[model samples]
Target chain A: MDFAPLLGKANFWAYFFIMLTGLYGMAVKRNLVKKIIGLGIFQTAIMLFYVSIGSKEGATIPILTAADAAGRGGIDAAAYINPLPHVLMLTAIVVSVATLGVALALTLRLWRRYGTLEEDEILARLRGDPGGEACTPRS
Target chain B: MIQEINAAILLLLMVCAVAALQVRDLMGAAILFGAYSFLMCLQWVSLGAVDVGFTEATIGAGVSSALFFAAIFRTTRRTKD
Candidate 1:
């Protein structure tokens, strides 16, 4: 019904597509590292969405400049874009790094344990498939 | 207007994302992901989030790529699928 709002904003659709792309990659890719990359892309897409919503036309950052002090009637809150989303994204970014590190570490361990990064192969090995020989049990 | 530039950047982001996923070489994928992060940083800068852009450039592009490279070196570089 309300096509106007949805059609007018291009950024939202762009971010939406990016998020979808990340999800598709995460789900379809068999390699663990590729899955991790997809997760990173998904995180960035969400961050972009949040930051985009907090933006305002003709507004500067949240920090007040000296020009604002010289202006009349104190400082107008509307002059600065919303800071909360960006602040939250900062933490999200750090968390993404931590998550990536831990995920990669786990991936490394998995690779060492199974000698393969493919999920299906790992699953097959875990299932004690005839070809994989029930994992080599490396140290 | 900044809108056109933003739109173009978003398109580039989509292309980069596809390329990153399509690439068979894991090392290449990691590099492409780094480029995607850098472009995302530019998008943030154009969107008036300079601090967020800086952090993305440093953490997303720089440190993340480094960690990815380290992992790739330790693991297999080519994807069977």
Candidate 2:
């Protein structure tokens, strides 16, 4: 085996595990906060995967140099990392932050609406009377 | 050489994921998830994805974790399990 191809393979597996962990947390955890955290993890894993795909071995930054500035076609760009993915990731990071801010704001509103943050407790309060002693499934 | 480094980062990521899952405390889990993101940034760096690593470190490890904690602060930290 050449073993060279395996160099970046670990990134793929790390992404996969991170994704699975996030998914598992999202699915199993009942707390709204936990769910949000899980979603964050999931998003992070995806970003990692996207970024890892653009990486190349022994590649320089994809920028034009003064020495190659006079060239008609552009710089001698051999072994240069892809710039497109970097640009895309920057956009994605901005979007993710915006969305997260909105989500946090919504969570605050939810807390204000109900005295408790627990999903079951909120549901009980929303159902009319939370003081009922009857044994009922929260959700 | 690169393979070994990648593998080490991968192992670190896996451990962080497991710790995030197995912890009984929700806050602890959120922090572990942040650590996982940090390791993942390193993994991306090893893969030559500097841009991705930068985003992961900032948004993933930084903003996302803060947002998650904020959301959690709005909700109950205790879990039935």
lDDT of candidate 1 over B5-79, digit per residue (tens)? 777788889999988888999999999999999999998998788889999999999999999999999998989
Give the DockQ (2 decimals) of all models. 0.73, 0.51
**lDDT top scorer:** 1
Question: A20 in model 1: Cα distance from truth in Å?
Answer: 0.8
**Candidate 2 off by > 4 Å:** A1-8, A66-74, A128-139, B69-76
Candidate 1 structure lDDT: 0.88
lDDT of each residue in B2-68, candidate 2, tens digit only: 6787787788877887777667777887798889878877876766667767877988899778877
Interface RMSD of each: 1.4, 2.7
Worst 10 residues of 2 chain A by lDDT: A130-139
| Candidate 2, A1-139: lDDT as tens digits | 8855654576777788888988986787656666666676677677767777776778766766665555554575676787777778778767777876886687678888875545666666777767633335544
Q: State iRMS for model 2.
A: 2.7
